[model samples]
Target: MTHSTDSNQTLFERAKALIPGGVNSPVRAFRAVGGTPRFIQRAQGAYMWDANGRRYIDYIGSWGPMILGHGHPAVLEAVQKAALEGFSFGAPTEREVELAEEIIRHVPSMEMIRLVSSGTEAGMSAIRLARGATGRAKIIKFNGCYHGHADSLLVKAGSGLATFGHATSAGVPPEVVQHTLVLEYNDVAQLEEAFALHGKDVACVIMEPIAGNMNFVRAGVPFMRRARELCTQHGALLVIDEVMTGFRVALGGAQSLYAQQIPGFRPDLTVLGKVIGGGMPLAAFGGPRAIMEQLAPLGPVYQAGTLSGNPVATACGLATLREIARPGFYEALAARTRALTDGLTGAAQAAGVDFCADSEGGMFGFFLLPRLPQNYPEVLTTDGARFNRLFHGLLDGGVYIAPALYEAGFVSAAHSAQDVADTVALAREVFGKL
Candidate 1:
């Protein structure tokens, strides 16, 4: 294969002149890997074609919405049919109600739900609802959990628990994040201490139950159980953000998994996105009737979007959900994902490389280390330079993974056993070179 600077270089150069960092999203620029981004022309069933017509196995899955894979026949048909009727009505629609009912039915924790246009909207609204219901101001969140760029949730860890959080981004005012407490993930002791000190004034504790942005580190079972207990004891709501793991992890989302692991455990509010939209721009937040009633025209706390429950988006989501509910959908999907991760792990081991990997359902991540990392700090201990080499090697071998090591990878139902085998073979070759 000849490496040419014609198409990709030309497109990137033109893009940089119009878009900041030559990409709509920062990480997509391949900044972490130090290369020109591959401009994708089309995607279908576990493969994507670049502008140069080069094909590669796609593992990003549009950051998790394409669980059934790009251009799924049913989803595409639903979206197309809905499009003929109309797009956004800004009024009530039967499809929206049906989609909401479907989600509430699967996620028992949600007694009522409100649609939103994006995960950030759902998360931000959930926080507002929590505050309105509790009549409290403070909220606690975990570090390294990317819950969107909401100002209040954008704070990094401060010097101490009692100290106010420092803004992680430039524009976010320090005062805005002062009441937002940032704590380390998997640190049960700190969680308890924070609750003990400020439990009275706290509105909620929001977290990504399974932190995917930090490469799929999960909240320790004990930590998760204890967090729920303390929130209830403190009169604070437990808000589970499942934007990435929602339907992708399980039919009912992360909360369902938690319920099985911890008896009598359920979040007060759950935020959902990704697979629910089926590659469209849609998201939602829901909870018990009493708490959810506090939002919008029902109560003082206000949240609304013009595109909320757009008919096409709802149709796509409904179709995707219905398909996943089919018999053996999850079983087959999980098996395929397991095959890919297991095969890669085995190949790396054979190549005499230190690799640790973990997966749940269709989402997975791996580290260039011997054991799985328990927290963000531990995850940072990975050899990033080595990872960059591996990433480029795999790309050159016609496989596409996440550009950054901190992001988790996805395996859609469209991926075949052959795709998994080929990916493992490529990884083996990459590991040998490393």
Candidate 2:
């Protein structure tokens, strides 16, 4: 099939004229891979068909929310049933309570949660609550860890250690991020030193337990332990941003995995999105009653959303969570993810291509290097030209991965053994050319 045919090209041309970069999300423009973005007409289990009637095995999984793949039966039914009842009440609903209870039940750290329309809102609210509860104005975030597009968090590390973060985006003022300290991922010593210098003023240390934006890197065990210990010692809240890994990594989330290694491990606050929404616009942040109670009506920190918990969104999220909670769901998904990564690595080796990959559950990332990158700087050393060739090659062979190298890829429960084999075969073909 000719992917760049008029069918998709025409739509993209129209879109670019109307929408910025011809896409709502920056990566969807395919600017990194250098191609016209596919205009998806429809999607099914593990597959998406573009406007040109070309089908590809979908590995992006809508970034992370489609863990059960597009059009899950249970989720679809629940959403439809909810739409019949109402769309948004702009008030409370029994379904909202049920959804909150479900999330709180799975993650013990969240004694209470407030739902929002997107991950950015959830993250921003969490930070505000942290500062208000602790009466501190500063926060520490890792370089590659993405909490959301919130202005204060949209920052990069400055030239020297202990320096305040600088705004990465154009519109964000430098003063906004003056109190935000950006550090390197998995650097225990650097983290400790930062805490030593500014611990008293810091309200929270926010991080993605498994960093997904820099393509699936994890904090070392020692680093994780030290951060938790220092946060407790400094009276700073440890906020785990699990928007991507929440239910996609495991049933209990990435926090549960950490609890296994660290005794009594739990974040003072947690940020959640993606899979919890099950492909809808829903996200949340919560913690023990004390900190959460700081948000409006109960205390000084104020946050509110007009459509906080839409009936349809709650129904979709609730149904998706219930399905994934079934016994052995994650085990099967993890096996499929492992098969994909291991197969691709083996094929790359046979083709004499320098490559490495890593995975947790359904989320995974690969790099064109001899060893996996441990931090943002190392992740940038990838061969961009070679990766572009591989990306287009796989795309032409009917496989869809993320358009950018720094973005993580996802596998879904809808994927089968045959799907894994086909993806590996396609990668081997692409590696041969590289």
Per-prediction TM-score to the true structure, in the order listed: 0.96, 0.97
Model-by-model lDDT, in order? 0.88, 0.90
Candidate 2 error regions (>4 Å):
1-5, 157-167
Scored by lDDT, model 1 comes in at: 0.88
Clashes of each: 0, 0
Candidate 1 error regions (>4 Å): 1-5, 157-167
Q: Could you tell me which 10 consecutive residues in candidate 2 have the lowest summed lDDT?
A: 157-166
lDDT of 2 by residue, 259-296 (tens): 99999999999999999999999999999999998989
Q: Which candidate should be chosen as best, given lDDT against the real structure?
A: 2
lDDT over C-alpha atoms for residue 411 of model 2: 97
TM-score of 1: 0.96
